[model samples]
Target: MLNLNQDPQIILWALTKDTYWHPDDHWQAVDRRCKELSTGEIFAVIDDIVHHFVHAPVVILTGKNVWQREDFDQILGKMAPILPSAIALNNPRLSHAALLSRWKDLGLTSVYLRLQNPRTLHGRQTVALAEAVVDHGMRLEIMTAVTPRTLPWLPGLADLMLSVGAASWQLGFNESLQRSKLDAKTLEQTLVWVADFAATSPLRVLPIGAPQYQRIVSDRYPLLDAGRIALREARGIAYINHHGLVYPGVNLPFAGGNLRQSSFSNIYRESPTFCALRDPRPLEGRCGFCDYHLTCGGSRTRAFRETGKLYAEDPGCWNPQTA
Candidate 1:
């Protein structure tokens, strides 16, 4: 029984300061990029973009600097009022007990916690964390770098499994990037390992990795396809973070070309999930071919950058070249 009225699930994964090339420029960039839109538009853009990718019922915000919880909260507070329904919190920084407490206070529906460090914890300590999560009525999503054999050692734990970064390549790729990485067989074996342990336990086993690996999974394993998986298995969800230009309808950006044109309005509408930062009316009568025409408020930034207008063709649009 799927709940149609429920808001779509989204996951906003911000890069860590170290990983972000222009850490100091983020706030300014965000403001500049979204300046043309209103609060509603911002929410719509984010919602649409996320919905386009994974139609999950839960959204998770990842890659926050938990060490600066106060700073993180401050930034989130500013964004929260607009995206009130969003469950915004630092990534798996708090202890299990602290996490439970925060989840309750924040009215969070789900949380993604990193379990990488716990592999070194004593058996008792690990058990305590696991027990606290289950007992506290908190959904435990585990992100770890440990091998499959060690997962069962923390039995009756981990309702959701997430593999991050390099560890993901270990899960599998359509084509191995390097010989050191795990092949499809190894990845399937590992998933089977976790699936066997969770056996009808209502636990979801997901391998969260790079876009390439995610695409491979989505293509190979039906269960790994976010939309299809969510529709079939009511248990858990999967998300793929890929970088691609979206256009109205099936108009993709020029393939294998550097000069791709896109329209601001089309991108917003094509985005599976996004938040609109402005009103939708300004884009009417623009981009005539856009099937989502009237409602497809163009992307202001993309439009201006490409054509110096708020309702022009996206410089990334590839329909002409393809035709």
Candidate 2:
């Protein structure tokens, strides 16, 4: 009764917790004191990965100061024996050349950094980290939150992204902070602008939580073969918190199961929440009847955040149509 073949290609493992600063609180882990995964716990996860996906999925080790643990480099060394890894760090202090060189030596392929508000000095530091990541022969992926305060930074942000040689950029709305949230019209316009910008730039521009990006890109450039334009959340993208609880996406708080409690494959294949999310036929409102339901299932997390129902229509989608 379920399709067990939808294996995840990427997993964000938050092995540590830091103080949360971004409006999208569920998205980033930094600046706070919290529990961290132990060496044994981490290896169990790695072991599960080996036996789970058809091919090894990219694992992103993220949190405040992951290197704070003295055993972190050793952890990297252990993971190297099994799978290559990357890390997402937000601390400016940890972006120095020496540490980055060590990360490269450990077989890290990329670095993920966040730039919440690029106007401040901290924003510049975030950009500097991006440059450092590129200088060290590693891929750089920059993620930023889209708030009313950050919307105007688009042009300047694009310029900085080019200067830093970033490989990809992920932009998501600040769904946590009420005052900073974008209206439906503004969200649609922003996605369209990003879609147009992505067409000419070498950078992969992904609207983190906005599934409407798929419909916008397809409708705008119906002639070009743009490939798949959807958020790969429940459809093969997942997140795991420090406690080993697996989620459909970084922003999607619904957990499939805990790695310590069960095998990763079982949770992914049998979780009701996961199964429902992957099958968009039961989606309600505009999303259910939309032509792009297969590709753009809409943001189920955003729907749950606003309407208290997982199957509700995405508030950010502007398509006023029905089947």
Candidate 3:
């Protein structure tokens, strides 16, 4: 029953993600697990869209510099034949990208570049890199962090994304304690701008996390069913840290299970903590009463961040009751 066809999301820890990769025996075991997962020896079927399997298998490298680091390059080279992971690289040296030539041969189907402000120097490099990714016949995406300073630039950024032919774009607000300091007006303004821009733009632009939760609760966005939302975060998504600690999402305090203790497919399907997060009946506040409550219960991570409980409604939501 540990089949990956049901839910497939893999975040392969890279050396660049704050964790050191030592070539020790434990490291060898981790590598072996990765190979098995990549080669389908660990599960019945891995739903990878790159291989045209199903609606899942969005495997990401979880860090940048994969192209620059020799260790990652060696590991990726070995798994390239069967795995074909899509990489998300941060601030890349786009000018000297001879690596693009090997992308197809190495089974790298797409590249997602995370850019900050479009007006900044690093942002310009992002656009150039996006164009290069497209020219290489690989899919490209642009993800920008939304801060108070970065808010006003999104309109121009949307145009830039369209110009570069990126497949999608995301405006991800900070999810940590900084969210508390963020002006509510700025957050709402950013949401409205994204809602309006997405309506007009051919490029797929989306607001992530709390902004998105706001949209769903305020009837600006579609309400997802419990099953869909459950699979998406409560169960479907997996953020395995460099040490292979599997959490429901990024920077979460708890782990559903560790990949070292069980097969990834098994842990994703049957972890008690993850399963508890899926129950939609006991959702609190206005989120529990709204018919869409099952789908849009607000940001559970933000709930935990603000209220110390994942089941608590999001404090970031304008209505303390609505979140």
Candidate 4:
């Protein structure tokens, strides 16, 4: 069930810094170093979220290669009782059915596969892993970055994910590693295409760091009925990096507070970062003048990346007339 009351519903936790497949040189928003938190540290974060937040958030376990750690299964076993969680991995070893069965036994509701290089042999393994995840009665999600190289494959990719019984497919832009080659018109066209695709397909298409998608799609679909994909940063989502630092969203790098120092609930309710992100009135330029500012304030991460201001207009937003 999706939490529709504006309380936090999703929390992304960077479980480890060790990556097994490829580095996020072309996609990550902030550069993360090699640092792995101890099981105690992980448990403390989980407990804070459980005790502080108004509701139990669906914790999404993330890392470059979370499965690289030998004790990860043990860690998951301990964390499951506190809150429901899902795991994301980039390992080809996930194609094995036994491993998926083990994760199912561990009480994971879903499994996310980060398909970075979907044009290579790793892509094939990801497909196999997706099938195995569904076969084992666990939900499967495919997450990939939208780059110049990957853009052309999206239509086909959507078809592939649908064929494999994937529950959702998330597409996000490259924020820091490299400047995006895609322009405003290009992005708008892409979102329009996705909007059209989503209306008829059963598979959910989610866009990260591109909240403008909501405004674009709202022209055709009812905004309230658009599902959780319409939700934006600080509205019902938060991110915790490997160091236990909390942020408004996955791509938004501004930190509210550190779990090691303060309670998650206090920071979430009182921090300037969280407060600013939640209230769209402070946005400047086009974002402030747009009619959909309250519900779809253009991506704050993209604004920061392009203009060095968190509240600046999204450079990729192609909306001509301002409200």
Candidate 5:
């Protein structure tokens, strides 16, 4: 079940790990919260992230599942050469061999399907869904959001996902911005349960969009001192929302610059807000004093949300000394 107030020191790498995909959701909008990107803007942002050392070539494309434009394949054709590893999140409505063959032709290495529909993950369709991904020779990563309602079922869900041949399962904790949040105690317990359960499971269980827990990710999460605030969210796992508003992540609403006017690299490297986040001088509390501040500065987003300070102590951390 749930472990209470577990020692975070012994299991830093067991929980957090490096994210292989750079989430570029706003690139192409599908609905109200989604934003569309031009062909020029797409390449421009990719160039920016790589040049700025903010991210690698691999990117996570989230937004509209369906790419209706005929030119969509053309755009991917251009990026395929530069991006060797690209993961697209798609709906699991169709799992036929023909659809799988089509996805393989699109230069996609992985297809992330959300297991939100209880019927999909738990129903008889589970086996078929897993077979479609595996038979297609594409890595399958299943994602599901963890909310107050879903907390208790997470452990069982992870097991079921693995049973279906899911290569990885991403448990996304609900965001306060979405009118949902799990308390620190409950969150820690949940993580402990996951880490313990997945420690032996063949399946890879990862926190959705979180890099702060990299230390606990076994041997997977790199221990590079790459400036967590900038690398993980701001620069590394940067978020460019619809309307071209750029931030380190959603937690910090301050826009670095609009993608419409300034280039992504220029905005990422030159923006005062972004630059300050990369700088380690102003970090406060344990993050400021620790040697791991550059690489493990807790979560700037969480700090901003809880303390309203760019460099404050992370509320999720009970003993900064353990870090």
Candidate 6:
């Protein structure tokens, strides 16, 4: 079990497609989910999960550009009906000052800007925006889609730096590799570059998805052990679409396809090393010395679908001794 002094600090939900979907349809789904959940229930669940995982705050990211103040206000108004705890503005086309002003007015706690593909700004402009965010006193997060070759030259300006895709993973599973059809060595090089960048930066590095997490934990854990990168400082955050399944505490599975075939259960199962020990009953397993048990409950739906039992032995359990 991991010994964590602090609780999980943040719970960010990527409400990406909502910006592209029709507002009413998007809201209806959200309303239905929250209909039976009282304010106290909602807060309790959120707090419990956050506390268990040591997460600090919760935020929602809208994957769209806000071009004007009115556009920002409109998005906030629409968001108000849903009453999300926080908001992350992604790829805003507006100037830094304008975006910051609007975010402040909306009472947003955090804002994430993508440094990977800046359509409107150059490197200098990106640096200026980071400066403006610090000036405005808004919590800042940065997303990078650059490889090691390109990243070193870019200014180190973000508080939290997120690798947008599987740049740190092995070749076959990396979407970028599939797009470029690169070899394994090239993929390894890119992962090394990411590690090198993280080694130099004080900002936290987050892997984008589950594949990246698998590769990092399996292949790159050695690199971390060698002190080439800080595994403790590196984290993972997944983006789930509407089809994704929600596990009460761990993560919302959104890898694609039916939840059953996604390996959600295999990767996160109830065991001494895997289950959230604090809440073992929910998972119906014993995992000793696992500090993350309560905070990192196994994927509930995945276990159900894989084993045909809601709270039974996790078919995905890999560590037989613990099982």
Where model 1 places Cα greater than 4 Å from the true spot, the runs are 1-10, 15-56, 66-102, 117-119, 122-130, 146-180, 194-199, 209-323
> Model 3 — TM-score against the truth?
0.76
TM per model? Answer: 0.42, 0.87, 0.76, 0.85, 0.70, 0.45
Lowest lDDT 10-mer window, candidate 1?
250-259
Expressed as tens digits, the lDDT of each residue in 125-162 for candidate 6 is 66467557666776656655445443443443232232
The C-alpha stretches of model 4 lying farther than 4 A from their native spots are: 1-6, 18-36, 68-71, 91-98, 116-119, 176-178, 223-229
Comparison by TM-score, 1 against 4, better one? 4
Worst 10 residues of 4 by lDDT: 18-27
lDDT of 5 by residue, 1-323 (tens): 11111100000000011122222344323223434556666667656554554224345554444344445566555655565444444445554345666656877676676675455444345446666888778888887777787777776777678666788887776433233477655666666677667667888777743444543343233443232232344545455553455666644566688877887656666788777776767878877776566655666777776677878855564333444
Which model, 4 or 5, shows the larger TM-score?
A: 4
Clashes of 5: 16
CA lDDT of each candidate?
0.34, 0.74, 0.59, 0.74, 0.56, 0.39
What are the per-residue Cα lDDT tens digits for candidate 1 across 1-323?
Answer: 33311233332333222122221355335424532223343345444444443333444444334324334454343343333223323333235456466544455434444443344554345445545655666565554543444434434334223212111111211111122244334554444554454334344554432112222334355463443322110012222111222211111121111002332234332333222222233443333454333222233333443355544533322222221
RMSD values, in order shown: 13.3, 4.0, 6.1, 4.0, 8.9, 10.9
lDDT of 2 by residue, 241-312 (tens): 776677887656677877778877777778886787888778898888898888787888777777878888
Sorted on lDDT, best first, the list reads: 4, 2, 3, 5, 6, 1
lDDT score, candidate 6, position 71: 41
lDDT per residue, candidate 3, 1-323, as tens digits?
A: 22332455444444344332322466446544652222232122222223443344566675435555555555455555566467777666566356776865677777878887756787777777788888988878788878766666777777788888898886766554364366555566566667666666777665656533434324554432123342235444666555456666664556677555665555656787667666667667655665555555656777676677777765555542343
What is the alpha-carbon lDDT of model 6 when measured against the actual structure? 0.39
Q: Give model 5's TM-score versus the native structure.
A: 0.70
Give me the runs in candidate 2 sitting further than 4 Å from their true place.
1-5, 18-35, 80-84, 176-179, 223-229, 320-323
Flag the better candidate by lDDT, 1 or 5: 5
Among the numbered candidates, top TM-score falls to 2
